[model samples]
Target: MTLLAVQVLMWIVVGAAATGFASWLAHRSYRRFLRKSRGPVSKSLGRGDVPTKLDTLIDPLEAQFPCQSGLATLLDNADAFAARALSAAQAGRSLDLMYYIWRTDVTGWLLLDALVAAADRGVRVRLLLDDVNVQGFDPAFLALTQHPQIEVRLFNPTRNRGHVVRRTFEMLLGLARFNRRMHGKLWIADGRLAIIGGRNIADTYFATLDADTRNSVDADMLLVGPKVDAVAALFDSYWNLGLSMPILALWPGFKLNRTAFRHRLARHVGSAPSRHYLARTLDSRTPEAVLAGRLHWTDKVQLLADPPDKAYGNHSAAWMSTAIADILTNAQSEVRLITPYFVPGQAGISGLTALAARGVKISLLTNALAATDMLLVYGAYRRYRGALLAAGGSIHEFSPLPKNGRKRDMLHSKVFVIDGRQAIVGSLNFDLRSAFTNTELGLLFEHPTLVADITGMIDALSAPDQAYTVSRPDHALQWTVARPGLPKLMYVEPEASKLQRAISWLVGLLPIQAYL
Candidate 1:
């Protein structure tokens, strides 16, 4: 009897210990989430500066919906419009443009020529871009800074103008305090219309049939109405506050006048054309108003944003993920996701697993080895092959190198479509870094025809013969299968290479994955 009493006591003690450990772990996890959630972001501008009329601009967004009066999708050539947009600024009463990176490729030239023309015509042009990404920018292109009407600035330009070693260490040690990019890709024209979305200023994004061989698709939106002013204002604030070179500072010998040029350029811009500018514009406000316009949305959707943390009362990443979760949680049928980077941590996998367990079709389309720019990210991504495949999620890898002669292109579009009802394609990546680290943007469209169009475009991209898929049997020993392919297409361990790849890989291995 005494032995029995002791056994019961021991069991009770064990249960308490287990509960304590569980409680401790639960508390730790909760703390971790809180750290990530960080309190709501403060507004960029104080309440005194808040535009009371900004809400009035939202009416244009409504016109974009098919039913509600918002934009459907601009099936136009993004590059051509990009050319027009840059040129339109030459006629600028005022032009504000911002981007993460502006490569000096053919696409860059098209954009640059337009801007220079605008400056020559006398427009007030503000150009803001990420200095880190533009490290190797062409010197000739950099010379364009000498123009009078334009104010060119870097988001966080580094002082180490000499060696790769110093610049790299600066990036690594976090010495580049402002290294965090202004990820917002925006173009505001005369404060009347704007273009915002996932495409940075580059050629791969425009994907012309002539220039694009692989035929990877990307999307952006042209917004008209009151919302544009707010976007324009955001561009202005960042531009005015960002880094600048006082002309003579960068080029003491070339510049003769600053004020005269500014005055003269302003006059020229006034003489440029506005009626000739062309781009798609989206808007519609009330549900009733949408019907009156003969516009119809594929689904009832809400436009949510990070807003200036304090003003919008949400983090950009959380708001975006919640939208994804809402789609996943409420999905009655299938979930189709098209993201360039398919790196999802534990929570993402679990959410996908839950949906798959309930007999829903879950599928993903992302970049293959040859199709990505960040190979290490793909290296990190390859680690989850087993879990994702085990969850009954079928995957397809896109090959940037098309069967045709088109130069291979990384599949850079970010798209999320739920049950064929609604879809989003914009600047947001599925990775955690994009969520918490960068200020991202994208448009969510609700028209079924638009959804179908996006889905169809994805299907065409996936139709290529050589896509990587994770089979259930393969998932059984998937880790082994995923291992061998690393060195072939990825930069897993290392083989010394030229500066670019080597640096990218070393940067990839740093402990600061959260900051990437």
Candidate 2:
């Protein structure tokens, strides 16, 4: 071999050896961490006795709302914050929360403070969060769990707890196991009142303070009565699953001093921003009305949630997608959908075409390239737009500069309104990830009032200036861009950067379509 060739071969061998050693070290560290932290422990939430005060509080609201059996109230934007915080504060027995993302932002700490108060009042609080979003916030959660009545668990936890190098290594090495996330979001109190929908517990989801704090436009449902019980049962199932690891179990050395911990949390909550939230939440009338004998409730609602082991397989039996499919198939007249990430792979395209063929008027509203948070997802979604439009589907993409002229916000709400009779709302998105990877939950109901309310919201959102309608004029792709007042301007699919378009094109060539 030549001298230069020998040197190049030597470098390749060295690089391979380094890579192999790194992988071996990662595997070894993960195994040791798991071995040290392994344990079997306590029972799940919702098994405790119902509180007397809980019954007393519900009686008056029950009489006022008069929901015969099942009911839900739409909690939009800031009101969602009230629904969640108030539910926790007013709980007399149990408080259970499960979310995919629980950030340590202003909104997050405020809710944490409320849970602390609930725990102080002897309301048993159980918090279950997906581990992906809680990487650096473990110490805060661990401190909160110091309260004797509170327990925090992480679903599908990373084996490398606090070590950054090991964490990244395991995540890269164990992609399949780590990729399937728990996307369901729920907040239930006293097994009587609940809030379930797309809103994660963060300032961005609430957007009460200012436009800068608003990351996306979203919605949640504040539900009371029989529906809450079903939600609690779902929480229990996941809480007891083998995949959930308690906070203390994950880091046993983190000692819990209840008094000191509460004090520190109190100080954190007393910060200026937190105080503002506290004042806003306390003064909010929506929460007062919700807790105090108000809110019209209907009795025609059904809860649908994916099993905790959904990533194992996808079929007609266990996934929320099955339920959603059934709803769409049953729609005879019209179907309207709103999702941030709209990658409806082959099955979705085929199903929608079939529905359109059956004379079902379908309207799809999603985030435009400029309005989407995930460029890769947007690219995946863009590839199917032509096919869907050809199938007689009307597509509207939200504009970055919406009619209400705030900071650019992404579309995060996931809603399915079918036949103007059923409204399905929750954390399930239209992309392949939500369909086949993450666990999802939603409420499907046949209440005319609720359906009309949600449908009206969709109508307003798809109106002239709020979104850009994608049309195929003369069998060519065109965007009817709506400015404030002038006639709609035509462009060749505006609102996306050239770089973004290129990235989308490249993404479409990848073999990860099923996992987008």
The lDDT leader among the candidates is 2
lDDT of 2 by residue, 216-244 (tens): 77767777776777787788888876677
What does the lDDT come to for candidate 2? Answer: 0.79
Q: All candidates' TM-scores?
A: 0.64, 0.88
lDDT of 1 by residue, 1-516 (tens): 699999999999999897667656654543353344322221122223232232234435445643332344433444424433532632335456777878765545546656777767665566667666766662433466666566556554554444788656445444324444556677754454456666776555665444343444566655544344456555555554423222223323554354564454444334322111212211212322321232233334443333323111234444556666766788878888877786676677788889989988888888765566676676556655567788788877765334467666567677777788777766777776666555566666577676777788767766634344445573353211122324333322222245544554465455544544
Lowest-sum lDDT 10-residue window in model 2: 38-47
What is candidate 2's CA lDDT for residue 495? 63
Task: Name the weakest run of 10 consecutive residues (lDDT summed) in model 1.
Answer: 274-283
* Candidate 2: Cα lDDT at 119: 86
The whole-model lDDT of each prediction reads: 0.55, 0.79
What TM-score does candidate 2 get on C-alpha atoms? Answer: 0.88
**Regions more than 4 Å wrong, model 1:** 1-92, 138-148, 162-166, 175-179, 208-216, 233-237, 240-328, 400-404, 464-468, 474-516
